[model samples]
Target chain A: MSTLETAAQPEYLCRIAIDPLSRVEGHGKVTLFTDRDHHIRQARLHIVEFRGFEKFIQGRPYWEVPVVVQRLCGICPVSHNLAASKAVDQLVGAHEITPTAEKIRRLMHYGQTLQSHAVHFFHLASPDFLFEFDAEVARRNIGGVMADYPDVARQGVRLRKYGQEVIRVTAGKRVHGTGNVPGGVNKALTLQERNYLLADLDLMIQWGRNIVKLIKQAYALNPGYFSDFATIRSNYLSLVRADGALDLYHGGLRTKNDQGQILFDHLDYRRYAQVLREQVKPWSYMKFPFINSLGPDRGWYRVGPLARINNCDFIPTPLAEDERREFAALGEGQPVHLTLAYHWARMIELLHAAEAIHELLLDPDIFGDELVVRGEMAREGVGVIEAPRGTLFHHYRINEDGLIEKANLIVSTTNNNQAMNESIRQVAERYLDGKELTEPLLNQIEVAVRAYDPCLSCATHALGQMPLYVELVEAETGTVMDCLVRDADGTFRHSG
Target chain B: MSEEQSFTLDGRRVPFQAGQTIMAAALAAGVYIPHLCFNREFAPHGSCRVCLVGVNGRMQAACTTPAAAGQTVESETGEIREIRRGILQMLFVEGNHVCPACEKSGACQLQAVAYYVGMLAPHYTHFYPRRPVDASHPEAVIDFNRCILCELCVRASRDVDGKNVFAVQGRGIEAHLVVNTPSGKLGATDFSIHDKAAQVCPTGAILTKHRGYEIPIGQRLYDRKPISVVGDVATLSESKGGRRHD
Candidate 1:
């Protein structure tokens, strides 16, 4: 009999696991399986918890949907806030909101993107990039980054603080603000608040440029290493303005295939159900979303920073446009599929956000008194926005009494599930070996997953405490052989 | 009642009337005991448990426990604070407390109490329990999902409004507030927006109609200051009982 067929043998079983994956917003685990010969067979990323938000929201008032769903993720509440607001706006029968309301919503969205992207780059992903992934666990962290490159670390902190300040000044607080409403925002920006944000524009713009410059320097240090790391070619999706310029707040849905060919463009988001559908996998609480034309397997597409940068023809702002061109060049006349490119694209978007904020602040309409537009009620509506991570879809159906009958939310990370798995497999094949399971090898898997900056919290509507444990197990007996425990602060040590 | 008595509250000698509970004495003396469902206008209902305080090295609900002379009452102590946070966590998990989406968020006593007690994250498992929202009332809505079972509405409806329109119907986790009407609908009852019961909800469970965001969130009662400073102010300000658009 073939050794691979020997299922009863305990020693022949092989599994590698990274539980409660670190640095991400919420709980997730990675499990790698190999055959008896130790040939890697499959690698799967499992979302362990489910919040059942869709099921629980059944009888909630439609007006409350926006505010309630924002609780899904403290890291990206504004995305859910605005997405739910847009969906309810349709239900309220206001096809277009007032000019002032639109500007305020746009401002909030930009603030969210800037803050979320900053936290990911500085707090979550930068440690792996700045310190080599193989560096000592203690020395490879924000503290280490601070000790070695104090200026860069300081800038990152200051930049994130500035983004948070924008959110606080505009939305009432840094997280779970009650500023957004169904037809528009609750209130307009006062001149004092506007001036407060505008005063920091110069410093923020400079810091954004410095961040892009710093990323370029890091890329220069190891051009070939990042260029070929965890690369996966797939279809990309995002929102674009009518002229095909990048738009985060309101626009038509656009998607491109791996060859940089536009699969579709300028499609109405309200008609999303006709062209898009989600397929649930038993392995994950998160659903895999794909274009209806391509079916589940072939239809899988990528979303978030790299996807947005790739799918958009141009950015509206000049500084970000320049960076966009430079980024596009790295694709070698095609789409850039290197997972590491997400970090670089994120910086470019950050610059665009600062520029966009500056532009919005300059407009006098931002100070208008007209904040909300109450319209006739409708039964159903859909809202879509390009969240910091990617395009987010919130669809709701309400009864005559204005209570939610159903709610289906396709968060940013759900769209990337297939691509994330593919990237993990590619990473596993490159670094995971039966001979050894080192921390750096595990970090390689982490780096690949971190590229997407997946917020499993939002993706799965998850909350509560999770145990962070890594295990090397025997698949036959389902027994843990060796384990590593990760503390809440992201430090790891051998548990067994 | 006899002469006035005083207790050491968080190291401050706060004087109280003989008949007053620790929560009432604290509020009367300008000291805040963070609470929900214990309105100054109504009798004490310690159903929320957010006002738990350390008294003589033992935990007790400040709203229900009478202030004793010379007794050491610790409301702001770490152990007391942790207990309050645990109560808040339980309320958060037991019901659908989506603060971001609720109309009463900034003005909500439960939300403000949560903030005051430093319950930064809902550190417990979310029940995500499927609850009902009753929008049958034209001038008000009752979202049972946000109910913390404080019984303020039931007390106000029964005693203050003289309507007897609401009551607690079930027990344990299944315990819930129910409408007292032939059709079991708020719309079918004489529950008006002007009812005292409608204005007494600590959470968004009972909200006035068409007044969502009447005042922008930042300028709301609790938003203007921490709940510690705005204690009972959200309820006391409603004595005037009229909406003002800021």
Candidate 2:
């Protein structure tokens, strides 16, 4: 059966769509097909925006690729920055960057991960979870959280702000900082800036623990609902250290089968194209990435937080290691297929990030001055990093004249595209009925998608205003039956 | 110098010598006027129009309009700011000012000016013009795609560098920065990397070879402070060739 056909249910003849999916990064929609009998036939998540960063970077100078390609996603610029920089580092034949440069880059990566995850948890996903998913539309934003739980909201803002501050200090400015260069980074952390960030580490750690406890409590309060909602089984993929420990900044790529057995271990990222392949579907602009050996049917694997936690054997940090033990227990010797567990896993990573930052700060190398190493230039190279969302890859081929001949970027979100569709389908199958399309039903579908904290902007490389809305269209006649619109600021209204 | 008469600029007292334009007067008085294509070392060519100011409720180029005594000039007002922002947007779309990839990013007057005026989003449609990059020169490269048609290179080459190797060719929207050689290549001309034209580019149009990202990014000239306090285009245009040999 074809990929789109996998969601087939002959009984359904109508469509239920969550257009311009809200609380996500960019523009997307979830379309569910059902018959007159109210049984879901098929469901697919369609990424609406299409940006071709891969094509245009060609012909530009090789040194410019790192900077040019980072424009792919504003929210995750540091991911692109480091990925592109690492790719160029290969082109320059710099196999090992100086210690200071590596540490500084690692610091910046952690900052990006911390801030991005904080925003996803507090500003985006927490709203749904905090307000019980079916809360009034108007009181379901950051403002609403501020009014209800002012202290928790303040902690979120403060933690996210600290992450931004760390990024700003290490990268020059918070957004689109030009710190990462071809060979390595362009600057090092100053003593003053280090002290400033050092001052916040304690508070950030405390807040990270508090938030983790809150999420843990939430999971405990409704374990069954959280675990079963939109749940699906898929393979897991992430980068692991030599000992199979969680290493987001630098590590070897690893993949495990759905049963949690290692499929590939310590494989070089340059050979990623060999193990992974992209399958395009006509319905969505986003491509489906699957394991090359398994093919499309069972090759689809999960990435980001849950996958990272599942694939890694251990977390090096003390508190995160404890949380990892608990998280692992959820799977009971196998990979956790619970979709809502992604949020819990994200918090664990957040705690790990806080601990990692403290370790990096104490390292004397982070304050050193040898940031870049000049070297012989090569024709081709690839760089990969575990972004806040998932593993991001940037590969480039340059001509002898130092101009880029070809470029290909695999953003983190694209890896989860197929799995996201599968999760949406699971939600639709569970709650969606053709008898009546209700707001709560529409929101449940959204909650499933949001659990991934997918950055659609990075996934599709979108431009222009991204509006979120859901429509129920008759599959037979392609006519709209019901529609819900979500404005830019997270305000929901039933338009039709 | 006619007693160096003072004029009201953005409600601040700025004194100017005879024959100085509003931009020069503001620069000297430590006040910033957002501009491109207007340099103090050479004659002011108000071609970029990014520094258009309101004088007595009339729009005029700050680089060419002389500072008159007791004249009310508004440079930072809402209307003038909007006009400057619009002009910057037009310049952005006119050429591909890829700041992230450009060598002159942190030190580029264009980027700094854009930041100063708070031009966050490019509201207008992007032309995404397909311009060419001339890398024929061994020591210098000219990326026409980043040129804002400021003519700073043209003037610097003719006036200060005395190379006459650069010129603005064509007219109106179709105009472009061109090398004087018959082949229109920097390598075909005698323009040295040390030429003032090479140093005076407000954007990353003209860059010296092997010196790309040499100064790094954060610790670069303009990274520490705003362009207004970092000596504007005049001080930035001055050669600082003693740092490293490329």
lDDT of each: 0.81, 0.81
What tens digits encode model 1's per-residue C-alpha lDDT throughout A102-150? Answer: 9988888888788888888887778877888888777666777788889
Q: RMSD to native for every prediction?
A: 6.0, 4.7
Top candidate, metric TM-score: 2
Which TM-score does chain B of candidate 2 obtain? 0.91
Misplaced by over 4 Å in model 1 are A1-13, A433-435, A459-470, A474-496, B1-102, B109-131, B145-177, B194-197, B200-203, B210-214, B225-246
Q: Candidate 2: which pairs clash?
A: A12-A34, A12-A35, A13-A34, A13-A35, A14-A475, A19-A469, A19-A470, A20-A468, A38-A434
lDDT of 2 at A402: 71
Every candidate's TM-score, chain A alone? 0.94, 0.94
The weakest ten consecutive residues by lDDT in model 1 chain B span B237-246
Tens-digit lDDT track of model 2 for B36-123: 7777778888787888988888999998998888888988888878888887877787788877667677677788788888787778
Each candidate's fnat: 0.50, 0.32
TM-score of candidate 2 versus the correct structure, residues matched by position:
0.86
State the DockQ, from 0 to 1, for candidate 1.
0.38
lDDT of 1 at A417: 87
Query: Tens-digit lDDT track for model 2 on A1-496?
Result: 2233445553346766667677778777777777778777777888777788888877777777766777777777889989988888988889899999999998988888888889888887788778876787667767788899999889888888888887888877787777887788877887887888899898898898888899988988898998899898899989999998999887899999989899999999999999999998877788889999999888988899999999999999999999999889989899998999999899899889988998998898988988888788789999999998999888999875677788888888899988888887777777775447776677888889888988887644232124566676666667777777767655657786
